[model samples]
Target: MKGLFNLGPVFGYFFRKNDPNRTSNFNLRTMHFINKLSMAMFLVGFLVLLYRWFLR
Candidate 1:
């Protein structure tokens, strides 16, 4: 988790330096990907909670 947190700036540095777009597009794509992943996780978690609620 700690390593994962630290990856953001490392990725940002490379994304900013190498990309001509200055990380704007990089940030947008990253956010979009994260948003999708979070939604997927939320759906799975909601299903699990619903199952457990009915089971109880």
Candidate 2:
């Protein structure tokens, strides 16, 4: 149950090295890129909300 909400995978997604054994493919790479982008946008939005809330 703890693993379900863990942030480790989120951090790992950005920091982990590529696995040499993993096959590189166009679709998979594109999907991962999109995921990273969405995560970045979410983080930025969250920070902006926090800033506005605190400064108001």
Which candidate leads in TM-score?
A: 2
**Per-residue lDDT of candidate 1, residues 1-56 (tens digit):** 76765746544543453457555677887986786678668768989999999988
Q: lDDT for model 2, please.
A: 0.94
- Candidate-wise lDDT, in order: 0.69, 0.94
Using Cα atoms with residue i matched to residue i, what is each candidate's TM-score against the true structure? 0.52, 0.82
TM-score of candidate 1 relative to the true fold: 0.52
C-alpha RMSD by candidate, in order:
8.4, 2.3
Candidate 2 error regions (>4 Å)? 1-6
Residue 42 CA displacement from its true place in model 2, Å: 0.2
Output candidate 1 Cα RMSD: 8.4
